[model samples]
Structures are given as C-alpha cells and as structure tokens.
Target: MSAEIFDICVIGGGINGCGIARDAVGRGYSVCLAEMNDLASGTSSWSTKLIHGGLRYLEHYEFRLVREALRERELLWANAPHIIRPLRFVLPHHAGLRPAWMLRLGLFLYDHLGGRKLLPPARSLDLHQDPAGKPLKADYVRAFEYSDCWVDDARLVVLNARDAADRGAAIHTRTAVTAARRDGDCWRITLQEKDTGRESEIAARLLVNAGGPWADRVLSLSDQEGGEGEEGHRIRLVQGSHIVVPRLFAHDRCYIFQNTDGRIVFAIPYEGDFTLIGTTDRDYEGDPGDAAITPEETAYLCAAVNDYFRTPVTADQIVWSYAGVRPLYDDGASAAQEATRDYVLRRDGGDGGTPALVNIFGGKLTTYRRLGEAVLDHVEDVLGARGPAWTRRAALPGGDFPVTGFDDLVARLSADHPYLVPTHARRLARLYGTAAWDLLEGGEAALGQHFGADLYAAELRHLVAREWAATGEDVLWRRTKLGLRLSEAEQNAVADAVAELRAALPNRP
Candidate 1:
C-alpha cells in the first residue's frame, strides 16, 4: 500500500512519547504516534506515582537532574491541581543509614537548588513530638519532612496524548512499527494494527525511537542497517516493583524510610484503605514485556517495607502488585539502584547532517514535560522552524478549568450535580476537570444502570466517545482507577456491558 505522510513519526505511547507528540503537534508539526499496546501500559504507569526529584539523586551529585525535576514538580502541580497534589514525606533517620546531618544537608540543597515557590521547604522533625512520627519505632527519634508532588502517572500520559490528538496529532494504539526505512529525506514506516492485522504505511520527515526499555530492539528494526549508531549507546534495563497492602499508618503524610541495604522505600497512603510500598532495583536481562513481580521480588519488597513500618507486613498482606523495566542510559553502574535516572536524547544522523532519528533514554514522569521540550530542542534545528515551545504554559485537555482550587470546584460540582454522591462528585471533578460538564448531560434523566462506586452509563458513554476507551479495562484502569474499588461481579458487569455495546456498534474495530 502507498504510505501516508506526516511531518514527524513518534514511536511508543508512554509518557515521553506522548509528551513529545503533544508538544510537536501543538508547535505546528504534523505528528503520528504509534503504540504497540495501550498508552502508559509500560513503565509510565508502574512508577512510584510521585512527581518529585529523587532526593537520593542529590547524593549522586546529579544537581542538574534534581533541580530540573524539582522545578517541573511545582509546574505540574499548578497545572493539574486536581490529579496532582502536593505531598509531604516524613523521612525517619535511622542510625545506620546516612547520618541525620547529611540528610538535612541534602534536603537543604534540594530546597534551595530549585527555585522554591509554592511547595514548602524541608524542616527538621522530632519523631517523639511531631505528629508525623507516630507510626515509626521509638528508636527513630529524629527525622525530616520535605515536600514533593504526587501525580497519577497513567492519567498524565493519557492527558498528553489526548491533548496531542486535540491538536491534530494522529495517535494509533495497538499499532506496532514493522519496518522503518529511509526514503530520501523522509522515513517510510510500516505499522501493523495488532487487533485487525491490517497493515498501513506512513512516511515522515523525522523518526523518534522512544520505546522505553525496548528502544534498542526498535532501533534494531530501523531502516538504518544493523542498529549501528545504537551500538555504543546501550540501555540498562532495571526492574522495579511495588506492592499494595492495607494502610500501615495513619495521617495524610507519606513515609520515606531508608532500608538497611542503602535503598529507600515509600509507604504512602493509597486510595482510602491501602498503603502503597515498594521499588526494588534489580538488574533485568530478559524481554521488557514479560517483566513482572516474581516471588523473590515480592518477598524483597515486603521485607523492605516490613523493616521500616512498625506494623510488619507479609506477603499475605499484599493486595495487588505491579512491575516495570526502566531503560536507563548505561553508565556501567555496579548496582541497579546506582543507575542514573537522567534522560539522554541522541540525534542519529550522518556527518552531512541528514534529518535523523532521535532516541530517548532514561526519564521519569516528573521530568517528562521538560524532556518533551528538550526533545523538541534537539529536533528544532532539523525541522528548522517547526513551532515555539508552548507546553510549559499550556493546560492539558480537561485542565481548562481555572486554578481556583480543587475543593471549590468539588463543592461547585456537588451543588450543580445534586444527584451525585460526594465521592462520585469528587471523582468526576478529579478525573474530567472542566470536561465533567460534557458528561453530565441529561443529568439524572440520562443516567443508566449503576455498576456501583460512581460507575454509571453517563460517564462510561463520555469515556467511550471522548477518551478512546475501547475496552472495559480502558475505562476501569486508565480513564479512571475504579478497578481498585469495583467488585469482581461489578467488573464482570462492565466487561459484559462493553461487549454488548461493541456488538451493537456497526463499525466496531
């Protein structure tokens, strides 16, 4: 088949890919994004779910990465106040770990290194008197509290992709790039739709390999022979996993506990009833797609959390789990935890300056926006004058609502949609932002069968129509995290409803 053409072709639909696509489209570049699986179905969703500079990165003397991430933290918080909120982490200084004074020094630099604005600075805390210390053991008397932001990483990626589509970018999910070859100044690429087995081709002026852990594999498939340019630049795949257990402590604050092995773990309040803990950094040598929390990893995470929390948790206490492989730029670091989280964008063109493929290396959710801007920076010279950077100030889709405060918006929503329960009202406000109005049409009159916990036909219809929610899992997990709250029977009902709906549609894909 003849290939359709675009200005840019972005591979992968994770945070970095979506961010780049969003920025590229907004800046007047025609973009086509191809994802082999669901958006954020990779490491993006499996993040620690916090948008903060790694305090430990400061220990590695990565001042630039930390400052950039810290700066982006506030920017993201201000932009997505509903989904992203400021979180305070209480660090209990254990005797064997880095000395309390050293931690305080690190926090001092963390506060001042980045331009401190809305978020509060770190302060010394006495575990005996401070309320944030009640959960820790008596021996852990001295501690420190620092500020950071928490983001729904999956939603962040989806929102970027949504905005990209809104700005004329074509986002193709369940589409894998089968081949990429250089045809003159453009790249001729073949994409196979995973669901339909239909093949289509697209030509673009530039190609981007943002395949996260699978970046090398994607490069190996590129038109460029043998992935030669990618030889020297190898990505170290590290597996990190998290475990969810019943809430281990009280208070809205999160705990950052230092483990005996020099690694740190977070025990944060998840949803309303669970505590999320984990992240074990282990070297991975297999396929990124098959990465999962093995029994050993699970036991390690459980033991890590059990070491810090006064109330010990075991494998039986784990309610759920997830794992992801981070494609870190290999610096030959001996330990997985020692690997740099900094991202590198390499332009792959010859000495004669042909427009080439840009490959993205390691990056975190906190730095995705900046990373997007940087990717554009690298491509700007190649594209000449594509467009100016506008994402720094632009509001994402559903984030059009003014920054008047989330509570006020929730109250306003509650007042307007009187039928919606407080939880339901808040959930809608948090998920859809200003777009909640779009779903509330027909009000109670249009509402249909309730599958419990704010799952209604009104919202589901809106999701299917606007958010590209193809399957029940899309609605339950990505569009909304209702999967955590929905019962097994309710989940089955959702699957059945979606299946029925798909069957009824004349043009179901």
Candidate 2:
C-alpha cells in the first residue's frame, strides 16, 4: 500500500468520474482516478453526442432535469468550445402524433424553462420555403427549429480527465479497482493493472463509485453495503444505440423524429459526410461491454428516418453502428424509456470513525458538470470544504478562446500553419483550439511520419503524452473521428505506430 493517502479515489474515468475529479482537484483536494480501459471507452463515447436539454423529457414531467440540463448547455459549451458547438434541431410536426398546438406549447416551455442565453430561441419554420424542408417529405409542411449543442462526446470525457490531471489529480487508465474496504478514516483500495496483472494498493479519505454500467458490480466488490438491502441500489441497464449513415441532408440542422412507440430518435449531420442517427432505448441484460446493436434496432432506426425523409433510409445504408448501456438508477418505471435520467447519489460510512463512500448512479453527458458539483457537495460534507465552487467560470485546457471565436481560431491556425490544407487546419482548430499551435510546434517538418488521413506523428505524440491515449482507437475514434475516414490498412498502420510509440515510452509497463 502507498503511504501517501489521497483525499478522494474515483473508481471510473467516464464523464461523471472525470468531471468529479476535475472539480475536486480544482478545489484543492488531492484526487486519484482509475479506469479499467481507456478514458471514454464506455458509455461516455457511445452517446447521441448532443449537449441538449431533453426536449422529449418534458412529456415525462422531468422539468427540473430539463431545466438544469438546458442551463448547462451554454456553460459547458463556453468551457470547452473546441469540442462543443451550438446546433439547430428541426422537429417536424406529425399530424398522426402530437398535435401542432401541443408542439408549440412544448416549444414555448422549452424556450422559457431554462435560463437560455447565447443560444438562439426556438422558432417555427415554414417547410414549404425553407431549405430544411427540401430533404423531408412534402407532407411535413410545418416544423419547429430549436437550439442544442453538438459535442464530441468522447473528447468531452478526455478533456475533463485531462483538465483533472493538469490540476494535480492522479489519473490511471487501464487500471481497475478490484477491492476496497474501510480502514479507520480511509478506504484501502486495491488496484490491478489490466495489461500486466500487477496489483497495488492505495488509501483514500473517501471512495467514489462512478462506475456507470458497472456500478452495481463495483459496489458488490466493496465491504460496504448499499442503502437498505444486502444487494444495494439496483441500476437498470438500458442500452441506447446509434448508427452512422450517409449524410441524409445537406443542411447543418438535425432532425428529431417521434416514433409511434412513444420514443424519440435523432438524425444529425455528422463528420461532414455522414448522418448520425440513433438512440434506441431498451432494457438490457448481461455485460454492458458486450452490448451490441440488434437487427431489430437497425430496422427500427431505418424506419424512423424513412418516416420523414423524402428518400428512404435502408439498413444497408448504415456505415457504422454502436451501442452503450446506460446504468440508470432503477426507479421501477416499468419501461426502459420511462426510466428517469436524473442522478442519484448515495453516501455511506462518513461518520463515527468509518471512512466515506459515495455511489453515483444515473447521469447524462449534458449535466455532467452539474453532476460533478453535486457530488462535491457530498464530498464537502464528508471530507470538509477545502475550496469554494469554481468550475463554472473555468475554461478547460486548450479552450481559452471565446465560445464564438471558432472561425477566428481556424483562420488564425490556417495563417500560422500555411502548410496545412484548409480541411486539416479546420479539423485541428475544431479539436484542439488554441493547443493546435502546441501540436504544430516545429512546423510541418515536426509532424514526423504520416500514418494516413492527415494523422501525423506530432498529433499522436501529443495524444499519448497529454491525453492518456495509448491505442489507435483512443486516437482515431475518441480523440478524433478519423476512424470513419481512414481505410483499414491505414488504421492498421496507425495502430502499429501507436504500439511502437507505447513500447518506446520510458515508463512502459
């Protein structure tokens, strides 16, 4: 066991865990975080990739959740403008489903419920004359356009972890927490390296179970019991899946389609060439990692889009697909779609000489910052306050520019690195913001080996050294979406390069 004890030890490196670590460390608390896989390798990466107030959630009467998420949209965007940007969503009215007046009322509430600022307000659209109507069916004459934020979901997780690490938090990827038991005023945590199978132990004043889909399993590993029963708090594993297809529309706007089954699906413009359609919510069993999109889900998504688009979307049109299991606090809602998205925090063993443990259940990406703040409230109650709340005004690493300064940053990057093509400059600016200069320090010559698709050694080195990226998937998929554009052979080359790079590291396992 390490003699040095941390103030808090976070079990998972997903959004919630990383976000907590960032907030805590920034507040002057000593923190350590462990992730069994690469950061954002789980549910954080496999999202619908929007930072929006849940518009459909209004039907469920989750006003507080919606309002909080809506307020977070602009705040989060300002904090990480490089990976998040404003997006307009078009909700076409279906005469067979929700009535037009009801839609208008819903839009009114959506616009007024949250403290929406910077983002444009909702407006009714005339599909007959608008460009957004061209790709949709002629029957859809009226639609409502509202603002939401598009996020690089995986990058959001990584940036939070990166910020936490930069703020003096110890982040360990590919490390798992095998066992934890309360030891007087601290929790003795057993950690195992997934690759080497080496075991080590550390102590923390408090332990946080932000395990996401694996929350229940992690709770079982600890000596402490969850509230009430011996089985602990039950988390409903709801699998939400998404698919990538050829771009469905030329416009930048996204579409939200309402299915007859009381579920909603989104079809958004993605990767400059593909349409991102998704999110089927269904009850799931077995390992969360093993969750994959079923054929029925594919057909359902195809039908959902085909219901509105002038051109039909077939299953064959799918270019890529993914599924993620959302570990929701089992509220006994009876239906997976009806399950609440609000988070539940359970704190135990804080007083009477026992160590503290905080179990986080059920949270969404849009409200991750707020979730972190809430978790800190519990932490302060246990560990005592060290610093005041400060994450709201802080900008994440490489995100110091203005929220609306994306174009100016791109133009500046292009001017600085004239050797880079327009597309390359724009991509770098979009991903790294001000840090693009740091990546391109030595000009074009410093880029080193060109793996493929403008992915060079300089960016790879930066991802490895700064972003905790050890594998090609971490770089190609999470850090950047180049996996969609790269050929298999090119991908293999990138993988080989990453392996060689990892092997050459001074601290290689």
Candidate 3:
C-alpha cells in the first residue's frame, strides 16, 4: 500500500524530537513523530531535572550555550510555572576546590549575562549563621546561593507531544522507525510497533533524526552514510547517573558541591520526600536503550554526597536510581565532563536538492525551545520560508496559567474544590496546571471510588481520556509519581482498574 505522505517525519520522542514536532506542526506542516518506547523513556527523564545556565560550563568557556540556556530558563519557567519552579541552590565554598573570589565572579557574570527577570539574582551566604549553612561542615563558612528551575522532565516531553498532536501532528508511541531511504525527492520510512510487531510504511518530504543517543544507528538503519562536509558530523554518547535517597536536608534550597576531581554534584530536593543526588561523566560504549546505573556509579554518587553533607549517605539510603546516555557532539574534548552541551544541526536538502534529514547532537533540557526554533530555521533554509517562529509565547498544552500569579490560582482551586485534600489539590495543580479544573469537571459527584493514596477514578479516567496514558505504569510513574506512594496491592488494583476500564472503552487504542 502506498503510505500517506507528510511534510515532516520525526524519529525519536525525546525532548528534541517532540519539541521539533510541536514546533513544525504549529507552523502548518503536516508532521508525524514515532518513538520506540514511551515519550521521555530515554535520556529525557533521566536528567538532573535542572533548567539552569550550566555554571560549570563557564570553566569550559561555553558562554554562548550558557547564555542561551539561561534565557530559555526564564521562558520555560514563565510558560510552565507549576511544574517548573524556581529553586535556589547553595554552593559551598571549599578552600582547595574553588577559590571563593572565582566562584563569586562566575555568579556575577551569570546574573547579568542573560536577561533574568522573574527569578532572584545570586546572593552571598554566611554558612555560620544562615539556615542553609546547618547542613554543611564548619570549614565552609561562605557560600553562594543562586537560582535555577526544576522541571518534571518526563512530563515536559509528554506535554510537547500532546501539544504537537493537538496541532495536527500524528504521534506514534511504542513505534520505531526501522528504515528510512531517500526515494527520488521524497523519503520512504518504515515503522514497527514494539509490542505487536505491526509494521507501517510512510512517505515524508523531510526527515528529522532527533534520535538522541541512537542517532548514529538511525543514520545507519536508513542507509544514509555520512560523507564529506556537514553531513559527516556525528554524535558521541556519554553516560550519566543519579540516585534518590532519604531526605538529607531540611531546606527546600538545593546544594551544589564541588568534588576533588573538579566535577560538580547537585543535591536537590526530590518529590517532597527525597534528596536527588547525581551524575558522573563517562564515555558510554554500550547500548543507550539498555543503560543502567552500575554499582561503581552508585558508590561514586554516594561518596560525592557524603563528602560535603553533615549526615552520611550510604548505598542503603538509596530508594531509586536511574541512568541516561547523552548524545553529545564530539568536539575532540579530552574528558567526558569537558564535552560541549551545545547543539549542532546537520542539514541535507533544498531547491532542486534531495529531502533533508536534520540530526540534532548535544542539547540540554533548558535549551529545547531554542533548539526547536533553530531546527525550524534549518527546515526553512531547505523548504523555503514556511512560518514565523511563534513558540516563544505558545504554552505547551495546559500551561496557560498566568505566570506571576499562581498563588491566587491555587487558592481559587482550593476554594472551588473544597472536597479535595490539600495535598491532592496541590498535586492536581502541579500535574495539570490550569487544566486541573478540566480534569475535575465531573467533580466529587462523578468520582466513583478511591483506589488508595490520592489515586481516584476521576483522575485515572482523565489520564486515560486526555493524557494518552496506556498502562498503569504510564499513569502512576510518568503522568504522576504516585507509584512511590502506592503499595504493591494498590498498584495491582490500579492495574486491574485500568484493564477493566480499557476493556469497556469501545474506542480504546
């Protein structure tokens, strides 16, 4: 059968791919995005969960990258204030690790470099007297408290894909692009569903390989070999891991500690109950799809945390762990940590030229919007002028709430939904933002039964109906982190409910 042709076909559903699909579709392009696993199932979810100007990147002189990221940080925060909140990070000054004056200088540049409006500027701290100081050892009396934003990474990807779909982009989850070939001036593509082995073929005038860590594989599978000039540029995979442990500090502010090896580790507040600590840089050689935290990486993270915190953190304190492989562009850097996080775009079509495949290399979560716009610019170069860039003001799906006045919004929701528990109300506000009202439309009258721990029928039904939640894990883990709070039997009960609910739906996917 001849496949339906699209203006753009995007492979991989990570932040970059989803962002591109969302951008392209909004600009009046017929688009389709395919992902082998769930959205953000890859490196997107395993991020340090920070939307910040990489303070460490200053040492490497990546000023352009840092400035762009810092600017986008404000944009993202303004767009999704509920899920992405301003987080103050305390950086303890160690004598040998980093000179206090040098750190201060960096913070000074960071404050003035990019237009920082809503968030507070960096301030000096006295560890001996400040409450943020209590967690640190006596030697580090001086610290710098700076600002960054925390993101629900997985939700970010899903929201982008959702927005793309709403703008008429076809999204195929659990679907992998097995082959792509340039046929005449159009490209032929094949998609295989992972679960059912169902295969579908399609034609696209333009292809985008935003395949994160497996970009090279996509290039190879498509029989598109890198040749002389720009098309030959490649991506280097680097692995990073994070560990979640019992809360180590009392304050909401996160801590950035410098290690002996000149690397930095973050101890951020996680899920209202845990401290998220992370990340070692190592060249990854294994499959990106199968990356997991090793015992050595776990120990390294624990040791890095134990070095600065007053309280000791052993492996026993860890409750959850995750790892991700970053698809960075190799710039001939000697060390893994020194590799650039900036993105590079490879374009291959135009005029009387062949259809293009733009492969994105190395980008941070904070910079996806800018990356998306840059991608559209590349697409325009090949396809001629299509549409003006408008994603700057456009909210992703449900992020339409007024940015500066969230307190009033929350209070209004509380007043409106008096039956909702405070925690559940806050959870709804956090998860759905302004769309919480839409999710609770049927209200207490329609809520049939409570499964356990804030898992109600109304919410589950909303997840299934609106959020494209396919399985219990998708509902519990990705849509909301309720899995950590739910018991095994309660999880099974939700699973049973999902199955029953799915069986009854006539239009179930």
Candidate 4:
C-alpha cells in the first residue's frame, strides 16, 4: 500500500480520538487514527455510562462544565439514538444530609442551565406513594426525580471510529505509534503492529495526542522525537470502579444515594437482569491498563448501596466488576473526587517551529463530541480551514432514525426477517439502529454460529469486520454486555470460536 500522507494523525482510539477523527474527516481532511489496543479498552469504556450533566458537580460550582455537558446531552442523543436514551434518577431526601431546599435549588439550576427541550423537567416525588420508592428504605419518605441519558459507553467509541472510517479515515486498532519525529513540515510517524511485531511508517502534517490515560507517555515520545520540551500539562490518575449484581429493583428509575463522607453512588437498572452500582474516587499510581476493583472498593460500593436500599448489597452478590483510571488535569485538589472533570487542550509548536502536537487532558464521555469540535477548532486554526463544524447534526452510523422510533425499528426488523426471535430482534435493533439489516443480512439460518444469549456469529463477524473487536473480552464485555450473562465454560467456548474466526480474518482493523 502507498504511504499516502495524511493531514492529521491521531494517537488513540478512545472517545476523544475517534470523535476528533470523525469531525476532521467530515470536514474533508485526510485523517488516520491508531489505537494501542482495542477501541475504548481504557477510560472511555469504563464510564458510569451516563450522558447527563454532573449533578454532584454542582457542589464544586463548575457551572461552565455542567452547562456544556448538559447542552451535549440531548444533542448527542439526537445524533446517536440507538445507543443513547433518556433515564430518570431518584434522589431521596435525607433528614440530616443535604437539605431538601438545597437539593431543589441545584435541580432548578440543572434544569435551566442547558437548553432543556427534549427531556422532561425535574419533579418532586412522594416516595411513600410512588413505585420508585419500593426499593428504598422506609426513612426515605420523599425524593426528587430528574432526567438524564444512558449510553452504551464502549459502543459510543466504536461508533465514532466507524463514522470516521466511513468518512475516509483509516482506523488502525491494536497498533501503537512507536516513534514520531518532525520531518520539516510533516510528522514522520512509526507504527508497530502489536500482533505480528511488524512496523510501518506514515506521515502527517499534524499530530494529536488523544491518548487518555497515556497522554503523558505519548507526549514524551514527541519530545524525544523532535527535541521539544515536556510542554504537555501534568495529569493525575483517578481510579473509578463499579459492580454489577442481580437485579435489586424492578423499577427503571435509578437512585442517586448520598453518603456521609460527601460522596454519591448510583444504583441503576442494567442489562434487564442486574443492578449496576458503583464508583469510588481514589488517587491511583501505576499502569491504567491493569486497573481492577479492589476488595475494599467492592466493600465500599456494597456499603454505599446498603446505606440507602431496603435490599442490602453484599460482596458475595457482586456478579461482575470493572475499573478504569481517569487522567484528570492536575489542579492539585486535596481529594480525587474534588478533581475537575473539565477537559484541557494544550497546543505545542504553535509558533511555527515544527509540526503542531495537540495534547488532550481531563474530559468526560458526556462532552466528547463538543471536545472534538474544540480540538478541530485548534487544528483548523493551525492548519488551513477545511470545512465548517458539521458533527452537531450528523448521526453516527446505524443512528439515522429518531430516538423515539427505536421500538418501531425493532418491529420493522423482525418483520423483514421472520426467523429472528423477538429478543434477538430487539437486541439487534438497539445495537445497530438503521444498520441492523447490514449485520443481520441473512438472519438466523445464515448466522455463522450461535454463542448463547443471542450472540450469533453474524453479529460477531460484523463487530470484527466493522468495529475492530479482537479478544473475547472485546466481544463479550465491550461490543456487547454478554460477559455478565454467559457462563465461564460458555465464555471459553465463545473465545475459542472467535480465535478460530480471527485466524480466518485478513487483518485486525
């Protein structure tokens, strides 16, 4: 293949990198994005999976960050309705904790801060008389219900990469940029294939360091490559973790439980058969790829839920757990929870001495799209403008239909292929949106293999062919949440089948 020069080369296949690539490529810039591992194998996939403005952030008075996130909530939903949907949260009033008046005031500001058009406004609930209160303690007599959005976090990252790829950008997964040097006005980039130990060279007019947890590592590479100073800002690694257990409540509304230590934990309905609870903020050191939930963290999460729920959570009940380290811009906060969630963009070589390197820092999944727009604004400023910002209204792949039309799409999909079971059809429609037909082309009979829980070979092939899935974890956990549903032996069977399938495949991405 010819080493065609690119206008932009992004290092990272997480949400930020893919979002930027999609935006840049849509604007007519030649782009290439390389991920050291599977897309969103790190921070992006490990989020709380909510697209709402940070309700707890109101205590820190981060109005600007909250406003931007709130604005993107509905906008992102409209663009990717298949993977994004509205969710309601229940915040019960505690007699000795945050006063009811203060809670009301915060919700009021949250409602008006961002343009609240698509979602319903917040309302007070008589927990004693409401079904949402059935799972809560008797002491929690009253609560407030508010709106937010849920996202399939990993799928969001993959969809962004897919959109970028469809828009003419090359997405290189399981590939790492080993070296980068400034070659006059261009960046001489060296990429290593993780599997075969092969290396290749490419060139780009600009370089973007969107490596979330590895931002500093990639910036160090550029410094060694071009003799540039370590101009990238410092970042603090904060570990956040969650636990999933058998369903604790039948209600769809989630609970935002307040702890005495001034931290909040959420209990949300997940995967139809389980409850998702989590997130403890603690400073972390060492590699982010090895992040895992500790016994203490698991205990803390269980206790957090035990504090508010009638159905007490215990460590033995945890069916699955995950953890990820966030690379937050270091503002020297005393506590990890106190750290800022807002993003920072630092540009090097802006004075025309070498190729520009843009360093991304500290962002939430909720603001990824807006973050992309801001990144390209800097790129457009350094390089020549290619086209105006266009991602705000453009839907991601499989997300062309309206958010409310999801059930209708499911019905349509089942009708076209009568062989599909109702559960299978719903899963496909929810995951692929308008593109479900492409993944389920030949339906049940032609679906290469059946790996339990509606995870057929047809969908697996589509994930590998289109979404860059590699391992069983990538297929079971990220591509789909079947990891929690599949048994150990069943999981191994799927892994062996996928490995055999991978051997027959041409390339990783």
Say what the RMSD of model 2 is.
1.4
Return the top candidate by TM-score. Answer: 2
Tens-place lDDT per residue, model 2, 335-407, is 9999999998888878886888889999999999999999999889888999999999899888999999999
Q: Candidate 3: which stretches are off by over 4 Å?
A: 1-3, 227-231, 500-509
Name the lDDT value of residue 35 in candidate 3.
91
lDDT of candidate 1 over 148-250, digit per residue (tens): 8888888888888889998999988878999998878878899998878999888888898899998987887885542355356678999999988888877
- Candidate 1 vs 2: which has more TM-score: 2
TM-score of each: 0.95, 0.98, 0.96, 0.97
RMSD of each: 2.0, 1.4, 1.8, 1.8
Model 2 misplacement above 4 A: 230-232
Q: How close is candidate 1 to the true structure, as a TM-score?
A: 0.95
lDDT for 113 (candidate 4): 98
Alpha-carbon lDDT, every model: 0.84, 0.91, 0.86, 0.90
Pairing residues by index, what is the TM-score of model 2? 0.98
List ranges where model 1 is wrong by over 4 Å.
Answer: 1-3, 225-231, 350-355, 402-404, 500-509
Model 1: residue 229 alpha-carbon error in angstroms: 4.7
The TM-score, computed over Cα atoms with residue i paired to residue i, of candidate 3 is: 0.96
Residue 88 of model 3, lDDT score: 97
lDDT of 4 by residue, 216-331 (tens): 88977776442244753878899999999999988888999888888999999998899999799999999899999999999999998898889788988888899999989888
lDDT for 216 (candidate 4) = 81
